[model samples]
Target: MIWLVIILLLLSILLYLLLVPIIVVIDTINNTYYLELKGLAKASVIEDNIEVLKIKMRILFFKFYMYPLKKMAIKKSKKTKVLKPKNERFINSKNLKRVLRVIKSFNIKKFYMNLDTGDYAANAKLYPVFSFLNFYKATNCNVNFVGENNVQLIIQNRPVRIIKSFINL
Candidate 1:
């Protein structure tokens, strides 16, 4: 009856959240980097001081600033000696394949990079590799011999795909 309707509504909302794509945008030239979940939440690196940079997160109408170094300092001040469990993760061919699958799930929405290797011969060799990627509308890659480096990448993936990747493991 009413309970069934409410449960269905909740399940639909959960599915929407799990299926919605999370976007990660990074642009070194303009110094913009952020992770966004459509209209729900966004976290971006922002610098208020010349030396210290903080992460600013916005959820709904609320804004929060997180200082990374301050939290680490507070953790160091605590005297609690908690034994952490030994990490069992190791790099192997099998584990590497799993990691590759997880990375492949992400869709490259946009990618642009300009690289210079300082040596003209090295730059000439890499030019064709980057030029080949330029055939795709989503990518704009090039190599310069003028010693300038720039990168901009935008990728999106759904939580469900990430969960599935691990669940299969």
Candidate 2:
């Protein structure tokens, strides 16, 4: 009788272990909270900690597991921006083009900027430099600011996944 009980316990434990990975996937996909500050800021594709992924199914929901997230929140920000620094000149299309060209040359994968007010963040993506520059000129004046006295540029590129090759098609 005791041997049968031990075998049953072992089988239950194995079943639990097999189900854990499924639970984690469901939790991340279903329970994720996207706090969007559209006019202020927004976040997309936030990365989770690898350790949380390794956590036991029971303790994964604990507060300690959720700590250490890299988040820029408005209420927590204290650093004040010195309204327009001296060296930072107004961005013009010609000058902005030069800077973007340099950035493209270096092959910068990610660029991030947050407002001093701490309520906004600009996530800009640039790809294929020559075409982008041409598009900018076509939509805006060649002499002064690109659009509306402020150079408003938008670049759309597909999100890259590093592990796509490893996954079977």
Candidate 3:
């Protein structure tokens, strides 16, 4: 009886460990995403290699997401620090069928604008603020434009699924 109980406990522990990857899959399916970094900060994308770490299941229809990138990213980035990253926001106004999230933002700075082409990049400070309120200083963010002509928009640090969208097209 004692040996059987010990074996059961070990099995449960293994199951819990496996849930991390499953949670990532579920959140990836449920959420919509985008990436945007205004300017010279945009160049940082060349060095980015982000990945999903985990997810928090709050309710059947809602979840609290988490990323750990402070030491690995924010502190390392030369531009745009203390950015406000939000995750619970939805993408389409007409359809709750899909969800959208902002993911990350950078500290404000000035960038050269190419008004005719409508594409320009900005330059931010060398150091980041590292604010506690900035999603507890996490990482795995990105920068890009998203959405369609009907509901056009721009955002940052979207999920891998959102990024894969362009490749499919």
Candidate 4:
């Protein structure tokens, strides 16, 4: 009877030791799942807000830039040279809309602005760039301003996961 009791106690201890790891693994998985769901919710909210902001920007562009440009082009006719470069002429609101559309179509997961160029813009150009950066930042998107003049923003589909895991200490 004494030996049987000792064997029973040993069995219970062994079972507990074996189950502890399984419980811990289950808890870790649950926590990871919760984090993933939270991340997805955050991403969705950001995407919706970005869409609304883009629409507002398009309206502003049409009202402020495209309509006026169209009027000026009409007034110039074919004889009066506008004297603007062909590229500059093409960089109107329509082109901006197209660029925005492309950016959206790509379903950009991450955004980074590279504004290390030495070129100084007057208030005219400065306002738009500042506004764009503000808009991007407001959307809860990640924006890294690299100090390299030739560096362009790179978008990666899985950047969020990589960044999140990397920053996890």
Model 1 agreement with the true structure over 21-125: per-residue lDDT tens digits: 899999999999999998889999987674388899999899998887664433455577889897876687888978988998899988889998899999889
lDDT of each: 0.88, 0.34, 0.31, 0.36
| Residue range 1-169, candidate 2, lDDT tens digits | 9999999999986655433221101112234323222222222333455533222112333322233343546585588767855785689776666655433432222222211222222112222332365465443212221221122333322112212222323
State which candidate, 1 or 2, has the greater lDDT: 1
For candidate 4, the TM-score is 0.21
* lDDT score, candidate 2, position 72: 46
Pick by lDDT: 3 or 4, better one? 4
Output the worst ten-in-a-row residue range by lDDT, candidate 3: 38-47
Model 3 lDDT, full chain set: 0.31
Q: Estimate each model's TM-score.
A: 0.79, 0.21, 0.18, 0.21
Q: Which residue pairs overlap in candidate 1's backbone?
A: none
lDDT tens readout by residue for model 4, 1-169: 9999999999986655433211001121122111111112211111133232111112212322112112233354567656755555747886676555544432333333334344444333554666777675632212223434222222322334433344443
Top candidate by TM-score: 1
Candidate 3 lDDT over residue span 1-169, tens digit each: 9999999999976654433221111113223222322211111111123643333324334445444443553255577678678875655563332232122211222121111112323111211222222344332222223321121222223234343443342
User: What is the clash tally of candidate 4?
Assistant: 0
